[model samples]
Target chain A: MTAQALHQHQPHRPEDGHKLHGYPPGDLAIWVFILAELGAFFVLFTVYAFTRLKHLQLFAEMQRTLDSDAGMINTLLLITGSWCVARAVAAIKRNHCRASAHWLLAAIGSGVGFLIVKYFEYGAKFAAGINLDTNLFYTFYIALTAFHAMHVVLGMAILLLVWKKAMAGGYSAQDHHGMETGASYWHMVDLVWIILFPLVYVMR
Target chain B: MGVHFLNVIWVALMVATVLTWLIGKTGELSTAMVVAVLVISAVKGWLIIYDFMALRRVRLLWRGLVLGWLLLTLSIILLAYWLGIK
Candidate 1:
C-alpha cells in the first residue's frame, strides 16, 4: 500500500498469479482438483486397507512372495526426480532458462526411469505366476500400483510440456505457472509412490 | 552437504529395508517390527513429501492437506490390520 503504487500493471488474465485480487483462479482450480484427488485416493486406500486387513495372513503371504528390492529402487529414482524438479523451479525463478530446461528434462527422464522400473517389477510379478485374480491381496496390490503407474505416465507428459514451454519462452522469471503445475503434479506422483512403497511392498 | 545428505537418505532407506526383513524373519519381532515399520514409513513419507513434494516452504494449509490424507490413511490401515487379525 505504497502511496506511489497506484500505477502498477495488473494482469487481467486469471492463469497468471496476479488477478483482479487474491490468488489466481487456476491455482484455486489446481488446489480443488488436488483436494478431490486426495479424497478419491483416500476412499480407495481405506477400502484397500480394510480388505487387506480382513485377509491379513493372505496379504502377508502375498507380500512375502514379492520382491522388495525393485520397489525400493523405484522409490529412490522418483525421489531423485523430485530433487531435480525442485532445482528446475529454482533455476527458472533465477532466469536461467537453459538450466531450467535441463532440470525439467532430467525430471522427465527420471520419471521415465521410474516407470521402466515399475514395468520390470510388474513383469516379474506376472512372470512369477502372480496376478490380481490370484488372491484378495494381489487384487489391491495390482489395482493401487497400476493406478499409480498411470499417474506417473500423466506426470511425465506434463513435465515434457513444461520443458517445451520453458524453451519457447512461454514462461518468464515472474510467471512460470507451467513449472509450478508440473512440479505440483510430479510431487503428487511421488507422494502416491511413497504410500505405495510401504503399504504395498514393505508393510505386508 | 546437500548431495551427501540425500545420499544419506538413500542409505538410510536401504538399511531400513534390511532391518524390516530382519524383523520379519525374527518372528518374535513381528509385532514390534510392524509398529516400527509403520512409524519409520511415516517418517520416510514425510521426507518425501516435505523434501520432495516442496511442501515444506508452502503455506500451512497445504501441509495440512497432505497431513490430513496421511492421518486418514494411517487410521484406516490400523483398523484394517486389527480386523484382519480378529
Candidate 2:
C-alpha cells in the first residue's frame, strides 16, 4: 500500500483518451456509466409520478406517513458528503495527499450519518407494520428508496477504496482520475436523492 | 475549482432544497407550484453538474449531453404532472 506500489499498480493506458478532449474530471467511461444510471432512475421516477397521478389520494396519504424530517436530514447529510468529496478532489489536485484523505474521511463520515438516519426511518416504518406490499405508494416508496440506499452503499464502498489509495498517496495533482471517478459516483447518489426527497416526501 | 466556489455551490443547493420543501408545504397541487418545484430541482441539478462534477471545464458536447438529459427528463415529468393534475 505504499505510494510507489499503488502508483505502479495502475498501469499507464495512453489509449484511454480521457482528458484529451475537454471533458469532465473523471474517466470518460464513468461519465457514461453515470448517464446510464441516471437514465434508469429517471424511468423509475416517471413511473412513480404517473402512477401516483392515478391514485392521488392513496399517494398523498402514504406520503404523509413518511417522515419528511428524516428525509430532510438525510438530504443535508448527502449534500455535505458531496461537498467534502469536491474538496477532496481539490486538495489532491494541489498535491496535498494527506489533506485529501482527511476530506475523504469526512465525506465517508457523512455517508455513515445518512445510512444511520435511513436505518431509523426504515425501522420506524417496519415497526408500524408497513411493508412494500402495503400498497402502491408504499411499494414505490420502499422500492425507490431501497434501490437508492443500495447506490449509496456502493458509492461509500467506492469512496472507501479511493480514500485508502489516497492515504497511500496514489493520487496527485496530475493523476487522480480514480478519485474523480469515485467522487462523480457519490455526487450521482446525492443528485438522485435530491430529486427523490421532494417527489416522495414533500410533494402532494 | 476553488474551494470557495464549490462551497458556494453547496450552499446554493442547500437553499434550493429548503425552498423546494417550503413550496411543497404550501397546501396545494397547482400546476404553477409543481412547475416551480421542478424548475428548482433542475437548477440544483445543473449546479452540481457544473461545479461539483466539474462539467464547466468540459467540452460543450459532453456538458450539453448531461444538461440535456436533466432538462429532458424534468420536462417530461412536468408535462405528465400537468396533464394529470387537471
Candidate 3:
C-alpha cells in the first residue's frame, strides 16, 4: 500500500499531527498485552523482595552461590538483542527490508546466546543437586529465572517470525505494524531482565 | 530516531551494564550499594522503555504507564530493602 493509503486506514486524531505521534506505535492490542505482562512481573518481583526481608541471611547466602558473571553476560546479551530489534524496526520504517531482516536475525542470535548461557548456569545448579525445594531462596531463584527465560524463548520465536516476514518483503515504510509489535515484545523481555539480574544476583 | 542516535544509546547501555557488574563483583554488602545498583537499573530500564521500545514519542499515557510501572516496582523493592536494613 502507498503511504497515503496507509494514512487513510489509520484513525486521525487531532493530536496525531504526524503519522507516528499521539498513539503508541504498533497494534493497540500489543500494548495492552505488554502492560498486563508487566503487571504480572511486578507482583512476582514484589513478592520476592518482601520475602527476602523475612529471610535475609538465607537469600543473601544463596545469592552468593549464583554465578553473577553469567547473569551479567545474559544482561548484556538481552540489551544487545533489544538494540538490534530496535534497529530492525527503524530500518523497516525506512523501507529497508533487507537490513531490517538482518537486524532481526542479529536479535535472534543474541537471544540464542542468552539461552545457552542460562543453560550452563542451570546445568551447574542441577549438578550440585539444587532443586526447587532446596530452600526459599533457590525456589524463588529457579522459578523467577526460569519464568523469565521462557519469555525469552517466546520473544525469540516472535522475532523469528518477524524476520521471516521481513525477508519476504512483507513490511515497508508505509506499513510495518507487525514488525513494531514484535520489537515491542522483545524490548519488554530485555527490560524485565534488567531488573531481574540485579534483584536475583547482584543486589544484597 | 537516527541510526547514529540508536548506536549512542546502545553504547551507553553497555557502559552502564558493565558498571553494575563491577559493583556486584565488589561484594560489599551495604544499603548504599543496593541503592546504587537499583538506581542504575532504573536508568537502564528507562532507556530501554523510551528508546528501544520507541515509547518516547508516543502519547503520554503509554509512556507514563510503562515508566510508572518501572518506578513503582523499584520503589517497592527499595522499601523492602530499607525494612530489611532496619
Candidate 4:
C-alpha cells in the first residue's frame, strides 16, 4: 500500500479519536508489564547509585577496568535495533508486510550483535579472574549487566516471534496490535540500557 | 511517526551516544561532567519513551507515568552524586 493509501486507512476519525487518545499504541496488558519492569529496574538503579556514594573510590577504580568502547558499541546496537523496530511498526501500519519483516530481521540482527559484544566482554573479565565476588563494584557491574543482558535475550525472542508473524502476513494496517506490543517491550529494553550505560559505565 | 523523522531521530541518537562515549573517555571526574552525562541520558530516555514507544499521542497520564519514571530515576542518581561530592 502506498503512503497515501495508508493515511486514508488511519484510525484517526472522530469515532476513533477516543481510542487513540485514551491509551498508548500497544495493549494495556503490555503497558502494565512495562511499568512493572521499569519499577524493578528503578529500585536496582537507586540502590546502585546510593551504594556508589558509600564506595566512590571502589566504583571509580573498578569502573576503569571496564571497556567503555564495548558499552558504547552495545548502546549503538540497541539504538539501531530500536529504530529498526520502529520502522518495522511503521511499515506494518502501512500494510507493507515484506518491508516490515525485513526491518524486524534487521532489528534481530542488531540484537545478535549486542549479544556477541557482551559475550566477549564477559569472557575478558572472567579471563582476568574477575567474578561476581571480585568486590562491590565488580559485583554490581556483573549483576546489573547480567540482568540487563537477560532482558535483551528476552526482547530478541519476542522480536523473533513478531518477525515470524509479520512474514506470515499475520498483521496489517488495522490489526498490528501484536507488533506494537512487541515493539513497546523492545523499546523498554532499550530505555533501560540508555540509563544503564551511563550509570554503570560513564558516570564516575 | 514517519520513517524520515525516525531516521533523523536515529542519527541524532547516534550522535548523542558518541558524545557520551567521548565524554566518558576523557576520564575527567568533575561535577559538571557527571551532570552532563546524566542529562544526556535523560534526554535519550525521553526520546525512547515519547517517540519510539509511541507514547506521544497517548493520554497525558500514560506519558506522565513513563516520563516521571525517567525523571525520578535520574534525579535519584543526581542526588547520589551530590551526596558523594559533599
Q: Local distance difference test, per candidate?
A: 0.69, 0.84, 0.88, 0.89
Per-candidate chain B TM: 0.71, 0.92, 0.94, 0.95
Mind giving the per-residue lDDT tens digits that candidate 2 earns over B1-86? 77898999889988888888777666655888888888888898898888887777567998898788788778877876776777
- Quote the true-contact fraction of every model: 0.33, 0.57, 0.80, 0.87
Give per-residue CA lDDT, model 1, range A16-83, as digits (tens): 33222332211444555666777777788888787775576787777887667777778777777877
C-alpha displacement of A203 in model 2, angstroms?
1.5
Candidate 4 chain A, poorest ten consecutive residues by summed lDDT = A6-15
Tens digits of lDDT, candidate 4, A1-204: 354432233332123533545667766677788999999999999999999989989999889889999999999999999999999988887788999999999999999999999999999999999999999999899999999999999999999999999999999888887888899999999999999999998988
Q: In lDDT terms, how accurate is model 1?
A: 0.69
- lDDT digits (tens) for residues B1-86 of candidate 4: 78898998899899999999999998846899989998899889888887788787787999999999999999999999999999
Which stretch of 10 consecutive residues in model 1 chain B shows the poorest summed lDDT?
B21-30
| Candidate 2 lDDT tens digits, A1-204 | 344432342311223334533556666667778889999999998899889889988988788888888888898899899999999988988889999999999999999999999999999999999998999999999999999999999999999999999999899877888998899999989988878987898777
Q: Return the DockQ of model 4.
A: 0.71
Candidate with the greatest DockQ versus the true structure? 4
Candidate 4 accuracy as lDDT: 0.89
Candidate 3 chain A worst ten-residue window by lDDT: A6-15
Chain A TM-score (model 3)? 0.91
**How many clashing residue pairs appear in each of the predictions shown?**
1, 0, 0, 0
Two-way TM-score contest, 2 vs 4, winner: 4
Of 1 and 2, which scores higher on TM-score?
Answer: 2
DockQ of 3: 0.67
Q: Give the TM-score of candidate 2.
A: 0.90
